[model samples]
Target: MRVSSYVIGAPLSDERFYLLLHGIRGTLDKVPARTGAFLVENRGKPLVSPPWDSDDRARAHLTERGYLTDLPEENERQLLVEVATALHDAALALRPPSFFFVPAYTCNLRCPYCFQPHEMHAGRGVYAKIMSHEQVDDAFRVIDHFDRPGALAEHLDLSQEGQGTADSGSVRRGALGLFGGEPLQEQTRDVIGHIARRAAERGATLRAVTNAVQLDLFTDLLGPDGLAELQITLDGMSDLHDRRRVGPRFRKTFQRIVDNIDLALARGARVMVRVNVDRSNADELARMNAFFLERGWGSHRAFSAEAAVVTGDAGRETLVTRPELVEVLDTIRADQESCLASYEGYAHGVLSRALSGRYPFTQVANCGAETGMLMFDPRGDVYSCWDEVGFAEHRVGTYHGGTLHLDHEAARAWLSRFPGAIDQCSRCPYALIHTSGCAKQARDNTGSLFAAACEGFQSYFPRTLATIYEQVESCLLGEAERPGPRPPTRTLPIVDVTHGRTRPPRDEVLR
Candidate 1:
């Protein structure tokens, strides 16, 4: 018998109890001092002598919780593969089908740090071809192809259960997102309108990822009847944002985009302002938040702001780690007189789960790309990852000529990129949460899609977990001491394990 290699532990406030996370099992336990000591002594080692007697409850508990396993390392590795496979299957079964349309690869602005720069295309005319109405029709035909009776189950390799097939109408339709190059531009309004109508007819919601420079042109489609959501970027405040995301002739677009955001919000659109942060704009986040509050955007139910690390052409000198971004936000919050919440990065999800006393959701893969998402460009070529779009080598399939033709090898490569399938991630303690971090990034950094993209998951996990645990405990204790009758108990339903790791599936739990 041996302790599992995937257990992550953080000390609690009392020190007598420890918070231990069994990564593979997705179990979070408040272990007493005895069990904590046993874990510290035995983790990653085959037992030479038992830490406790055979009759000890601590031994039984650890074994039952998957902290101890009675298998060789290779056998245990196989078990991890099976666990990840089961989780992936569950995620596939529950996840809504996602589709993205890239009207063209050309953009209005030429941001120096643009991940998909036009110069990188080397004057390839493919970026200039706007998706025509004919291509839009073909796109819907492809959507119809997927919406056929058994197409969803067959395409995604999911088993049908009773009336869950695509023909049944019981399964809800998924998102249809408009993508680059600046999908919501004035030039493609007619095509965009046709696309929106088609999406509505198919019972799918319409959304867009745009810079919002020309969003005013699409105000008619901003409400509940039109786009369901908008992901707009604001690199920093006026001066910095203008410098970063400049239009042709270096046009000043700060105020125009801001006005368009207001128009979208007034029309009932959910606007998620993405502040792309690096050393260049990290200090500008708080001022941007202040602007949002002054504009009354912060209090709006449909508005939110988050700081995401800038990637791609931004050099190593400009980039900041996930924890550093969090710390920057915290410092800004401490200096502010306002009580509004700070911009949350990746840590928001962890903090939310901690407050609710629930285990964080385990990732089988990085994002929808590695799962079953399909993105189609103007040329009718399909890709798995958005970052890989417009590049032929990454093309997973094609929907040209009104027929779906899949490059089987490319498709298989993407579909099989889960943590269990990756060599380094298969044994890493943070595999379940990090999920081998960003396949595109892995290929870029290590020149292999299967390599681990660590990205500071190990460095930040312990401190973040411990700090959030203390905060939650303090908040709950305060609420418990309230003078009035306690609020009604909140019952959390057992969401599928892939969505959030509440419990393992009944048939698949390892003994």
Candidate 2:
């Protein structure tokens, strides 16, 4: 017998109890120090003797909980790959594909930290083109090809049991999204409305990720019956946000955006405000929430504000390490209502799922791109990832002249980019949670889509887990069994956000 390579545990405040999470099975429990120490000491090592001795109950617990397995390391790795692949296959068989249309790659704002080159937004480059009615119809043709009965079954090889048989009704209708260079601009308003109408005809929800500077121009189409959701960005208060998200000719945009948000909310549209935080704007988060409250935006059931760590091309000095960002969020949540300053932080999401007792399946890919997402740009180019848009070489296919052409080789690479296929990631304890991070990061950092792009998950996971574990301990254990007060939150040393161990130094952590 050997300790499972997927078992990871963090010692609780009591020191005598440890929180254990099985990476493969997603089972969580609190084990005594003896069990934790034994598992830790024997991890990845062969068990020459029965550590439990005659304690058959202890042995049974270890095996049944997936902490111990008799399979060799290579076999265990293969098992994980098989399990993850089967889960993905089943998911692909059941879910419809989601489409994102980038009307243009040109934006009105020149946010200093924007990742796209300034030339891309200059409206004179390859991105100068906008989606035309012909292109829109062509894109829908491609979508129709997928939505056709038995089309999904053609792609999925459901030869194995439990990998549900694909049928005409297997994959339901999907969603539509408007992406950028600024999808909601004055010039693109007509095309945006057309996209909404087509989405409505197909019964697909339409969403847009926009700066909201041009939102007023699209108010006629903003509501529950039109563009159902709008994801807007507000960096900070008016002064700080205006300075960061500068508009054309240095126009102030804070008030304009807030007014548009109000208009959208009043029109019955759901709005999600994304506050990108770095060292420069981290301290202003609470004040920003206060601003939202004063505007009465938070009072709307459909209105939400969340913090996101900024990793744009801003100066490294202005970027806060992942641990620092966590501390900032913890303080904000402590100071304000939980809903007032919430961040959909990766660690928090994983911990929530772990504690759910639902035995969530391990994540197969980093994001939807590897599953059912396809991004079609104005040039009729298709890409698996949004970050790869406008990069001609990264496109998975081209749809032009009402004909769809897919480079199966390129699409296959993205579909196969999962944790179990990466080298070090295949054995890492958190592989299932991080799922090898972002695939675009892998292509940029390692020059390959199949490689692991951890992006600080190692450092970020442990620190965030420790902090959140303390905050939610009461929910995990009975009052009589709960441990003492958690120790002070500790920050792990900063890890460069480039290599597999970290994120890109200048890109947002999309999750």
Per-candidate RMSD, Å = 7.0, 5.7
Which residue segments of model 1 deviate by more than 4 Å? 12-17, 31-42, 46-60, 93-96, 119-124, 148-153, 156-171, 333-363, 479-511
Residue runs of model 2 more than 4 Å from their true location after superposition: 37-42, 46-59, 148-165, 169-171, 340-356, 462-511
Give the per-residue lDDT digits (tens) of candidate 2, residues 1-511. 8889888776677878777777787777778877876786677777656556678898889889989889899888877777667656654555555677899898899887776777888777687898997789889877866763324334533224555444654444544777877889888987887888787787776777788898889877888778777777888889898998886754799989989999999998888777776778888877987777777776667776666565534677777765576667667666664443332244555676677766555456567666646678988789877766788988988988666677877876766667767877778777777777777767777788888866566665655665566667765665433221122121111112221112211111122
- Could you tell me how far off, in angstroms, the CA of residue 401 lies in candidate 1 after the best superposition? 3.4
Clashes of each: 0, 6
Best by the lDDT measure: 2
Between which residue pairs do clashes occur in model 1?
none
TM-score of 2: 0.85
TM, every model: 0.83, 0.85
Q: Rate the local accuracy (lDDT) of all candidates.
A: 0.66, 0.68
lDDT of 1 at 408: 71
